[model samples]
Target: MDNDEPLEPETQDEPETEPAPQNSDETLYCEAEASVAVDKDKAARESSETDLEIEDTEKFFTTGQRELYLEACKLMGVVPVSYFLRNMEESYMNLNHHGLGPNGTKAIAIALVNVSNNDLGLEGARIISEFLQRNISSLWNLQLSGNNFRDESAELLCQALSSNYQIKTLDLSHNQFSDKGGEYVGQMLALNIGLQSLDLSWNHFHVPGAVALCNGLRVNTTLQKLDLSMNGFGNEGATALGEVLRLNNSLVYLDISCNDITNDGVSKISKGLEVNESLKVLKLFLNPMSMDGAVSLILSIKRNPKSKMEEIDISNVLVSEQFLKILDGVCAIHPQLDVMYKSVQGFSAKKALLQWTNPMKLIQGYADQHKITVLDFFKSLNPKGVMTMPVGDFRKAMIQQDKVPVNLHQVRELIRKLDDKTGMVNFSLLKTVKP
Candidate 1:
């Protein structure tokens, strides 16, 4: 017999059997099975339909809804309100028959603030404040970044912060708050003690605004992380803020990028770091610092052996090989000085030209010929100091020399060949063509 073949019943003598009985239990079992099958099919259909509806709803958001959502995000410093509301509605409906949506107002009220429209993100704040007033013990996280907020709007926010104590994180980045508006918010920070992370980046917080904020930081101990990037604070402003950092021990992360801080500003901050131990991350990108400023910072890092600073950014500052060597030496010695170099991005035309002039391969070859490292040769050329030269001047200087440095010409030829192959070079080569 084949292993896969079906078995056949064997013929045998059979006995007589009693007739079947009609009972309610049999009827009920059959009905229950049928009902279960129907319910399963309905559930499958409903689930598929719900998924399709959610997809369609995602595709159908109106401009008004998007604006309202963005505004709510700026005021409350959280994810878009619509997204939060949708999830909250689903949760509420799943938990109870509370159809808290367009279908149920009470459910909607319980789940969402319904601030569909209104300027300065006040409606959402008002709703959240009102909810807290009713509950008295609920915790919330508010993030209101990238909204166009004016002075009047900031006042309402101050009022909300004055009363509410549950909100822990408040992000107010990218708002159009000037000195007056920032002062109002600063007042709130001074009195309110519940906030931990306050992000005020991309606002118009100039010197006056910073001074006002320093008043709050001086008194408030609850705030731990503060971001003040793209606010245009210069040396004086940073000096004032540094004074506050010197005294305050709660702040850990300070971001001051895109400011007009030069060597003087950095010097002031260095002074603050001398005593300040709580600060861990300090961002100082897009500042007008030369090698002098950089060296000063390195020296300070070396001096302060007990500083808690783990990372430092000196990007976009005019730096040289000497600066890099010093930083390399510092890293070798300290092992904790996490220094970052200015990347190729946003390099000035002059800087880019210089990089093209003195390619790294050429420098390495020149150093090899001189029986020393590239760093030593660079130091020898400018014994006292080497300022960051412009790209064009550096290129011209390299080519104008009597003899082209070893490997310099070779690297340039290689770059030209690659550029030609990639269709990037449309001009004639600078030097004579070599095989």
Candidate 2:
């Protein structure tokens, strides 16, 4: 042993170890490191993609069209993540709400011809008219809502409607179109047989406009649904539309809610409905059609067995106890027809009941599993075959074993609604249940 270093183990002579090949042809020393570098580069690219998401958010939402859309476009900043990832419809909606110039509107209109979103909202006035003039034949639906459309744009629309046949749905709501615009719309309605749905809501088109539109409807048969809500259609307008309804055989759904129409107006509609057979759904909310007008409509419905109306919306109307009594009488006659009595608040009772826990689904599953009706399932729980059970036991059995989470109070009310003769739920009355 030497003093300077520890003694090393003396071994037999061996050949220098060779670098092993990682693959059949690849060497560990150089080529393997190269493959690792390539993998690292690919990983770097993915990391940069994530970094791009972070960096893009810093300057997102460029308020490009703020001035044009007024305050409505204030929030129309380009959110970096959604902007790049959003589909055509999202892009169109974002483009629609914000302010856009003529060139921009034209671009969007041209783009819409190829996309599923046939609706374009060009707040740009003349640009929208020009787009309609050019692409009206290509579009199936055009929504020019909230545009400052006066007679000039109306003339353009009328010209488009005269020759165009492809466009079916047009929404010109939330504009300042007076009688002049309405007259042009009437001309369009008279000429365009392809138009099915028209929404002229929330505008200044009053009784004259309504009359002009009705004049067009006299000859038009293809129109199915019409929304003239919030256009201040007084008694005169309502009367005109009522007369048209009598003749317009193809029209199915009519929404004249919040149009300030009165009993005299609805009286005309009632008379028209007596002769009408195609109209199925009628919306008459937010109007002060005191009990008399509603009664008139109800009486007309009762008289006409051929009346196809399955639903009537009388929510928010000024009704007395007499009105409800009359409605109950009407319902007693036609339990299949749905009469919406109360206004839907911030939420819908039916919608919530369906969404939250799906107790109806649970009951349906139980009924299917047992191969019996829900009524039969309840009968199984009772020892004696009585027509009814205590509400407490019924609720407990459902909640504890079957796990149905329907509202107890609503259940009680539903029992009463189903069986007017008994305070408890009688399953035989299930035949009266309507969807």
Candidate 3:
């Protein structure tokens, strides 16, 4: 080779590449086992993490509930009551008559709980409405009875409840709310699907409000118990409720007592009872309705083939012999029904017919013996000169030997003939009688 080419011949030894490592079964097995071991470790770690997450979630909910109580106590500006603090998880709480005014009541409402008779004024109701609208809490039963909630508070609460699907029972009795509040409540009832029991007694729901409420009930199928007692709902209200009874099938207990309903109203309601099939208890006590109205109502119930009426309370309404007879006939057919009444309106004693053949003559004799005009005699009986007195009071005077010299049976008959259906005896009517 030439000298330049010969220099290239002194080549360094290239390290021989070892044959690529031959795949061994044992090595492949070791690698596969290592991969499986890694996967198992990862899975164990993930499972432990999931368990920890579950534990954390439980702790979070518990802490949240306690936080609600703590927040309420803070807003109330008082230490947590020991009973509530000790039983933080208890569902029922009775803090009635606690003197928790607006601020304290607001605090309690934020917790979405009960503290009835706590003087929760309109401000407290506002707070309750705010939380209800937020839809965070899961409160079901709400008792705000004896709270001083007004129309605005009622509107706010109704607005919240219109969309909420949680609350089941609500008590708004003994409040100052009136027709405006009642209208709002009616609107709420029209939209609400969860409420079942509502107590609106001792409010000022009159004809318009009552009609609106009943109209709402006509469409509602959830409410079971409704207390409209001690309101100003008159015959118009009764008529509206009668229409509701004709259509609604969910109402089971209806307390319309002490609502100034009269014979016309009862007659209207009787028409509904003729068709209704779900009403179990109808409370008509403490009303101005008479035996005729009560009798008509009972008869209507009897006429219904699908009536589920269990009890009809007309305890304060005066009954008659005819009413008792009709009731006996109805009870014979529906022995499961119970009718409650207090007294009979007419005289049933044997001597009553013989003694009081002419009640006007007996009264005229009493006035002549007293040497006073008939009007003057009534004026004497009525000390206040109001020209009217309770039938019971007039009956008491009639039975006094020195006053009217009439027997009990005779006095009852006289009052029955003279009663104005308002349980009042008008003195002006005596002027028309030629006794």
Model 2 misplaced regions, further than 4 Å: 1-106, 113-137, 318-322, 332-335, 343-370, 373-435
* lDDT by residue (tens digit), candidate 1, 1-435: 332343222112222331122221111111112247766574343323321122335544433233333333333322222223344425343212111122123222323332222233545445444444443434455566654666666777776776676677777787778888778877988887788888888889888877887887877787788889999778877887788778888887788988898889888887777777677667888888766777777777666666656557776766676676677566544443455546433446875565455454665677688688654543343324352332222323344343335222333443344244422321233233333
lDDT by residue for model 3 (166-263), tens: 88988888988888887898899999999999999998999989988887899998999999999989999999999999999999889999999999
What's the TM-score of every candidate structure?
0.53, 0.56, 0.61
Q: Which residue pairs does candidate 1 place in steric collision?
A: 74-144, 76-142, 76-143, 77-142, 77-143, 77-144, 78-143, 350-391, 353-391, 354-391
Per-residue lDDT for 287-366 in model 2, tens only? 77876787798888787776766557777755555665676566555443445555323545766565445344566677
The top-ranked prediction according to lDDT is: 3
Better of 2 and 3 by lDDT: 3
TM-score, candidate number 1: 0.53
Order the candidates by TM-score, highest first — what do you get? Answer: 3, 2, 1
Better of 1 and 2 by lDDT: 2
Positional deviation of residue 63's Cα in model 2 after best superposition, in angstroms: 32
Task: Determine the C-alpha RMSD for candidate 1 after optimal superposition of all C-alphas.
Answer: 19.9
